[model samples]
Structure formats: C-alpha cells, structure tokens
Target: MSVPETPSTSRYEISENPEGGITLNIHGNMGAANAGQMIDELTALLSDYSPSSLTVDLEKVDYLDDFGTLVLAHLRKLVTNGGNGFYVINSSDKIKELLSILHFDSLDEKMSIEKKRSSGIFIRIGEATLQHISDLKYAISFIGSIILSLVHICLHPRSLRTDDTIRYMQRVGVDGLPIVALISFLMGLIMAFMSSVQLEQFGANIYVASLVSLAMTRELGPIMTAIIVAGRSGSAFAAEIGTMKISEEVDALFTMGFNPVMFLVVPKLVAAAVMVPILTLFSDLFAIMGGLVVGVFMLDLTAGAYMSQTIKTLELFDVFWGVLKGGVFGVLITWIGCFRGFQVRGGAASVGQATTSAVVSSIFLIIMCDSVFSVILRYWG
Candidate 1:
C-alpha cells in the first residue's frame, strides 16, 4: 500500500484489484459542503466501470455528517442492486453507529410476491346448492309445526283464545281497511284507464267494466290485499313477538306451563285467516268502484250498464278462489312472522332483522303460491 498526501478537495481514487474486484477510496471531508459533488462523482464512476463486486474504503475520510451518510447509503444501495456484492471497509465507529441507526444495514434483498386464489364456477354453484337445501329444510320444519298446532286447536276448540283473536282481527283487519281500499281503488283506476285506451280503439269500452271486475275478483284483489297485510301485520307480529322473546317474556310464558304457540300464534293465525278474506272482499268492491269512476267519466258508460257487465262477467267461482287465496296468504304471513319472531336471538338488532325477514319471506311465499294457484286454475277451469 502506498500512502498519498491529503487532498484539499473531496475526491475518490478508483482501482482494479488483482483479486477480481474494484475498490473506490474516498478522501477529504465528506460533509454537506461537498455532498453533491460526491454523489455526482459516484454516479459517473458507476457509468464508467462495470464491476462484479465493490469495496468502498472510507478510512481516508476526515469527517462525515448526515448528508454525507445519506450519499454513502444511496451508493451502497446502487452497488448491491446491480447484482454485485457491496463491502464498506475501514469505517470509523461514528460512521458505523450512524448508519446502523438509519437502518441502512438492515435492508432486505429478497422480494415478496403475493399469490391470489381464483374463484371457480363449480365452487360457487356448490355453495348455492347447499344454501338452498338448508332453506328447504327450514321451510319444511315451519310448515310441520304450523300443521300440528292447527290440528291441536281443531281438536280442542275451548282452548282457543277468542278475545285475543278478535283483538288481533281488529288491529290487522279493520285498522288496515282505509289504506287497503285506497290502494285497490287506485289500482283499479289505473287498470281501467290503461285497458280502456286499447279497448276504445275498437269501440268496445264497455268491456273495461268486465276487465276490472274479473281481474280484481280473481287475481288483483287477493294478491294486493295479501301483500298489504303482509307488510303491515306480518312485520308487526315479528317485531312484537321478537321483542317479547328477547325480553324473556316468552320464556316466562313457557315456564308457567302455557303453550306459546297455542297462546300467541293461534290467535294471530285465526285473525289473519278470518280478516284477510273480509279485507279481500272489501278490496274487490273498492276496486270495482274505481273502475266505475273510469267507466262512467272517461268511457261515458252508464252506471247501470257498468254494474250489469261487471255482475255478468264475475262468476261465483272467481270470488270463491280469490277469497281462498286471501285465506292462504293470511296463514302464510302470520305463520312466517311468528316463526321469524320465535327465531329471534340477541338484542333489538336481531328483532329488527327478524321483522324484515318475516315481511320479505311472506311476500315471496305469496307470489310463489299465487303462481301455483294460477297454474292449477288454468288446468282445472
């Protein structure tokens, strides 16, 4: 090794070692005053030389500050990233301590890659299949429980709570009358107006009476009334019973040797079964009145003529089937509501979820059963 005189300016001496590596010796004060120059010189050296390994000699450096430490750290990073081994030799204790605290010595060279899993079609299909099977089982259990309860009530009539049943009927039926009538009347008006546009083209506007009457009696009347009751009474039943269940009142009833189903559910079921059909009849009448408004005003038909056409077109079986559909829908709404309520666990949030579920489930069942009725009536009639 040859000793060289101290230099006035910051500079570097690059040499090719016989041991198959390159050495860069930095001399003079490496501080903020000459940090930029040092970085520029290092950048030029990297462009000029291609070395398999690099050894940096820092022993000749007189002083090193935070900025100079940053430059050296950046240069070390460059050398290691170029597929070469980087070594720092003859570093003073102060320089080593500063670099150690800056975490430059702990840089990880290995890259981390994330692996993603693909969602396959068969996996999704299998999950859906299992969910549907679970739902079907739940439905079967609910239906069985309802049937057993009803049969028990039939065999033991005196055990039925008539007062509770009447009270529920008043709440679910009489209180719901004005809104149900209003909606049915609007629906009939819309149906009559829309149908009359096409019917009037052929000068057959008189048929609007028959169209609204038959549709209201056989299909719209029961369906609309049931949907209204499901939204109103079903959600109420779920929320009320769910609150009771959550508050432990239902458990108290059970502890007192009372049949919760017979006491709580049967009255609701009976009330719904009794009131819904009556509501359906009222819905049909209101809807016909609305159709009469369109007929007498828009179609310029006589009230007598409209009533006569409606009477002639609407048969006894049409009203019977509509009322039957109403009864079935009522039972479905009440049972599902009470069932969901009984299923409640936890707090008020669970009660709210149960109430929402009851309404949604009742509506779905109503639509499905109505479809089945349509199919059966098509074939049977």
Candidate 2:
C-alpha cells in the first residue's frame, strides 16, 4: 500500500549507503545502568562498519542522567580524536539540563571554570597570609619604639639609675631561677639519655657530655628558658598592665605627671632583656651538670674528663651568643605581651585573647629569630 510508512521503533537505527559509510541515531534514556549495554552494542556495530561521521539526534531524548551524558561524551571524543566528526542535533531542553550540570555546554571553554576555582581557592589563602604578615610587621615596629625609648633614656641618665631597676631585676632574675633550674635539669637528663643510646652504639659514650653541653649552651638552653619565662612572666606582665589600663590606674599615673612608659614598659622591658640571658645561663649550667650525672654513672666517664672535654669544646662566644639571643627574644616577648595587653579592647574576652595571642605570637617570633640566627651563624660562625 502507498500508505504513510511508520518510523522504526528500534532505539537505534543504523543505515549504510554506497556513497557514504554509516550513521547511527539513538533515542531513549541510556543512563548509567543502561549506558554500558548501549555502548557495547554501539561499539559492536561500529567495528563491523566503521563510520566516517556519527550524528546523535537527541530531539526525542526525554531525560538523561550522568551515565547517558558520559556515554555520549566518550563516543564524541573517540570520533573527534580519530580525525572523524561527531554531531549532536536537535537536543531537547531536558537533555541540555543534564549536559549543563556536567559542564559540557562548551567543552573547549572549560579553562575559565578552572581559572575561577584557582582564584577562589588560592586568593582567599593569600589574603589570610597577608594579614598574618601585617600583624608581624606591627610587632617589629614595636621594637623600634623600644630603641627610641632607650635613646630618650640615654639623653637622661637619671632614668636608668632607679629602684625600678633593682626591683625588676629581682622579679625577672631571682624569682625565675627555680623554674629554670627544674626545666634545664630535666631537659639535660632527657638529652643525655637519648643521645647515649645512639652514641653507645659507636662506642663514643664520652661524647654524650659534648652533645649535652653544646646543645644546651648553643641552642636548647636559650630557647627553652625564653619560652618558659614568656609563658610565666610575659603573661604576668600583660595581665598586670592590662588590668591597670582597664582600671584607670594608668590614667592616674599620667595625671600625676609620671611617664607610664618609664613606670611600666621600661621596667618590664629592661627586666626581661637583662634576666632572660641570666636564666638561660643558669639553664645551661644546670643542664650540663645533669648530663654529667649520667656520664659518670652510666657511661663510666669521670667527672674530670667530662668537664675537661666540655670546656675544651665550648667556646666563650657560644655561651655569649646564646645569652645575647635569649636577651633579644626576651625583649620581644615582654614588649609584645605588654603592648597587646595595653591595646586590649572590651573586657574579659579581650584579656583572654591578648594573653593567648601573646603566648602564641611570642613563641612564633622566638622561632623566627632562632632561624635567622641559625642562618647568620651558618655563614658567619
């Protein structure tokens, strides 16, 4: 009959012609669960009659999920990469929505999304890093203020010779001795035992004394003492000054015509700078003695040999430089703590924040300065 011919109900229709090679049209949902079987059938068909071009007519696609989208993408890529062509014609809005979600709208223009992601991730990170650097810079500027304060006092010699000096010395030096001794002794004992285990293997047990003395005098002693006093005395300085600042006592001092810097910052600053090295020296001596105990008892090295070797290896410059580094770190620690405390806003929260920031930032600055000194010593010493 010359009646209208009905379209084939087959999901895929293939045709071959004498003039051209082959064409395939697929219709229906070939999502993840069914995409595998669909691809297998399509590949089998393609192997039999390798087509020069493939056109997928998606006009009748009711919907597509991730699987169906992936199936189409892979076939398109294969044909395009093999010097063939792939075309999608008459896609429905429903299929477009799925493709859009997979970011397949413009396959060739995806560098922009990658650029956006890179910006979004690392740009925020850069801002955070810059903020930290700014905070550190502000802390460094505080050191300049201290130098100016010293120059002012230098012009007026009467300022340095005061009871404040003696009182501050007692607080920072004598009051700090017990804690320094305890920490140093324990540290030396730990280092000696740990080093002994390794050095004993090489039958160089006597070198344990050298290791403990060098480490204490050169590195561990100064760093550890600074950290302890920073936690102990630095926090105290902040809280005490912050309380005075909040309670209007600092205002009273100004009203009485007494310079608050001389009464407060100068005393604490001088105290920390002077006594931090003393504490570190104490730590070095105690730690060395602690290690000596282990050397005599376990390593069978006499106290005379241990002490002689220690003196022979340790230069006066090593001890002096360590103390100087301790002094510098101490000054920074106290200044920041007091400055942070004085700059506090609000109430208890601000106090807590200042105290915590003082400790954490003091530790960070201590570490940074240590690194700088290490680098300098590597080249200079």
Kindly give the number of clashing pairs for every candidate.
Answer: 0, 0
Per lDDT, the best of the predicted structures is 1
Model 1 off-target regions past 4 Å?
Answer: 1-138
Each candidate structure's TM-score, on Cα atoms with residue i matched to residue i, is 0.66, 0.63
lDDT of each: 0.89, 0.80
Instruction: State the lDDT of candidate 2 residue by residue for 100-121, as single tens digits.
Output: 8778745544423444434576
Give candidate 2 regions above 4 Å deviation.
1-141
Give the per-residue lDDT of model 1 (tens digit) for 85-172. 8888999898888778766566444324567876799998999999879767876787787778789989988888999999999999
Every candidate's CA RMSD: 12.0, 13.9
